[model samples]
Target: MRSFVRAGYNLRKKTGKWELKVRPDKDSMLGRGLLSEKEYHDPVRVFRKAFKEYRPEQFLEFLAEAVHFSLGPFNHAPEGNLIGPYLHLVKMIDAAWLIVERASAEK
Candidate 1:
């Protein structure tokens, strides 16, 4: 759950009734650096809460959006260190697979 990319990525996605808003500027190097000084909100909590409330199809959509928001910038940005994020990404995918497997077994 903790990774340099997750910690250094500061852009927040705002989901409004029918719209999603993002401010790329907030994810700048300086902005991300400041996060080290304060508490950073982990988006996994948002997804976890949504999973409990959303229907299966709705949860899929929400999950897709979450992955895109979390990984898109990390993938496209230039980075000197990729090992940490790469490992974290693999772990995240494995965790998602486990969730799917457990859910499928219950049905």
Candidate 2:
């Protein structure tokens, strides 16, 4: 299936804690709020709803906030509205794993 939002982990600059960074992929149609029904369902509506109820930054903020930190930059937005590399760390699996685990456990 096609991905809507790309999610990953990042450091909250001020608090110096790791946080999720979710962003719309540059080539994704979801980022533009242009998903076709035939392409997918729930995801289409999910992103559609997100784009309608939340501004792109609000999505970004939700994706980054500690409250929703597990959401991550990897799959930042359900609708694919958020985007970022936040950082350029190539070898991030170790850190990413820890963050994802914590976020999942919190949920």
List the candidates' TM-scores in order.
Answer: 0.29, 0.24
Per-model C-alpha lDDT, please? Answer: 0.36, 0.34
lDDT of 1 by residue, 1-107 (tens): 33322322222232222111343344454433222211112333333333344333433344455566677565554323344334334433433343344347658
Model 1 scores what on Cα lDDT? 0.36
Runs of candidate 1 exceeding 4 Å displacement: 1-78
lDDT of 2: 0.34
Candidate 2 lDDT tens digits, 2-102 = 11123321131223232324432443443323333321222223333334454445534544553365545555534443332221121122333444554
How high a TM-score does candidate 1 get? 0.29
